[model samples]
Target: MVMENEEVSFADTVFGFWEDSQVHSVNSSNSSNDEEENYDDEEETFCTKEKNKAFWEEQGQLLQATLCRTSSIETKVRHATKEALGELNASERRCICGQLEVAKAKSCCRNCLDRDIRDRLLSLGFNCYISKSKWNNSPGTPSGEHTYLEVIDTSNSKRGEVKVVIELSFRAEFEMARANEEYNQLIMKLPEVFVGKGERLRVLVKILCSAAKKCMKEKNIHLAPWRKQKYMLAKWLGTYDRSTMETLPRAYTNRPQKPKTSMLTYDLLEKIPGLHCTTAVEVV
Candidate 1:
């Protein structure tokens, strides 16, 4: 009987020990999980910072390299484009077609501004054209169309024709609403107006698209279809229809009107019979 009682007590003791160990184990596990979570958050923050820094540095290098490789024709076109913008800024003219402000490039009347710039470029002896690119809705990107200016240079007999793309709102186009500081700073480096060769423009597009993708990834947001690299490249590099916009009339000017006599009294006297009786006073 004593042996059986001892065995029972031993079994009970073992059970009690297991229950106590289980309680302590749960508490330790909870503590460990919290520490792990904190460590993960810290690591993520560190990685994000490093990534942003690296991205900005690499982008700067790429932009510098791309800008340095410019041709004589590109430089000439760029200067001409800037000169055209300065003239528009100083002029007090409105586009005849849109009847909108063209004094500033960022005017609400974007169409008018574009048309005016194209006209000015043509007048400056550059073979400029408006390129309209259209794409249908695909699996990834939606249907869209884009219009921008291009200056074609066929001056060199050996090099053939060179195409220079001009974008007035180049910097504003790449700006993001939910961008980090690094991304914003990188965008600031871009010119308000971009005038470069097709190859340079292509490189810039790739750089900006990658930056946009990184930004959205860090922010945990889905990038818009239009912001994708492929979509952006399709805008300029894709098949496009070109037009010189020669059909549009030139901007009308406000010329001085000739002084005329007041015919209001004569018209009223002739048209209105006895209903309107006017007393005419002669000035001596």
Candidate 2:
């Protein structure tokens, strides 16, 4: 009985040593895995920080370039204005027909207004076409649908070419509504006109109001600096405003077009053979 008890005690000691060795091995493996995980996390964090820093640095460089370009443009405009002012007669500042007050009270002739706008845009390095037929609506479609000017950027070849459809209005309330309607129609028709052409289109609504303050107050409309859409509405006291001309290029350059969508029709669906419609009224 004593020898049996001694053997059982010896067996228990061997089993306990084996169990302790197994536990020590597991703990060492766990510590190594924890260190690996911590090292990987720190590496990933360093990479993320480096990427964010590079992105912000690129953005800062772009902003600085834009500011330098804007400053250069302002200097050019100042010089141009000085030269233009030197050439203008006192009489030219007033109306040409000795009806300066009358012209101010009532808007000038469309031809005169268009000519002045074209001249200013040309000075700003834009190629302008007056009463351009390229922007006319389809024949017999609408008489009132027309664009006043088709302007293109002529200065920056690296920026690609930009096409702008400008509509001018002389009347206060009537012109604003007309401009909005025209812009909406142009937005709808642009995709069809420029399909596969890879060209971008922008619309500008230029309203000339005799009483700018009264008109703006009565209409309760404010011009937004920028919108998500490719069109802009601007009110000018006369043929052109310096601020408007300066900001106009940004409207079209580097601006992406809105996504195109097709209007579903029964004829379109009929093009697909073996397709059947269950109901008399179709739902898309």
Candidate 3:
């Protein structure tokens, strides 16, 4: 009887110890799991904080850059505006095109509107390269002979500068149609040329008309025509759809759809704290 009791007690004690050990093991496992979860949460928080810090820093840099750019643009505009006003005040005689002819002439023709426009651009710190044969090498030359102007930055050297190909029309209707044709041809050819040369091409059309009743007829008739032309150009050149279009079409296409990514990118860029658009053209 004593031996049986001792055996029973030993079995009960062993079973209780085993149960206690299992409970302790479970508690230990739970505590370890909690610590791991806490560590993961801390790690995620650290990563998020670092990302936020980097994003703000990048935004600050972009803001500074944007402000500097705006200041420079404003200065240029002031200078250009002063020069244009001075030219207008100095010129009294009207050319054949009914536009004022400035005094300085590169050639003998005083009645030439193109020359007057060229001179005006020159006064605005652009180098008129229209007369040069070398600069006249445009892909769409024979059918569309456009004037090319180099925007000279006096602050920087002449090695790298903004190159502009311009088509000036004294008449709005004729010019708009012609500009569209010319833009289409150039857009088709420029990509290949850009890829080969690793340079970007910028083209502009300047329409010059008198403020007289016969030419303008209304307060802002020119705005609609100009806006349409620019919109068509943007569409044809693939600038409007490049970022958001799903199916990859040709670079220069008549069909343009708003890109999904482009609006987001534009919004992000606009929200860069101090960024502002200061150029005559929004894209530029």
Clashing pairs in 3: 244-259, 244-260
Model 2: per-residue lDDT, tens digit, 25-121?
Answer: 9999999999999999999999976874564454444433432332333344334433433443211332333333223212544444445555666
List, residue by residue over 23-141, the lDDT tens digit for candidate 1.
99999999999999999999999997897788779998897788678888889888988887787776556556655634344452666677777888888899988888898889998
- Candidate 3 residues 40-115, lDDT tens each? 9999999976874564454444433432332353355335534543554455433333343323322223225334
Give Cα distance to truth, residue 251, candidate 1, Å: 3.4
Q: After superposition, how far is residue 114 of candidate 2 from its true place, in Å?
A: 11
The most accurate candidate by lDDT is: 1
Name model 3 segments beyond 4 Å from true: 1-7, 62-284
What is the overall TM-score of model 2 with all chains considered together? 0.30
TM-score of each: 0.73, 0.30, 0.30
User: For each candidate, how many residue pairs have backbone atoms clashing (under 3 Å)?
Assistant: 0, 0, 2
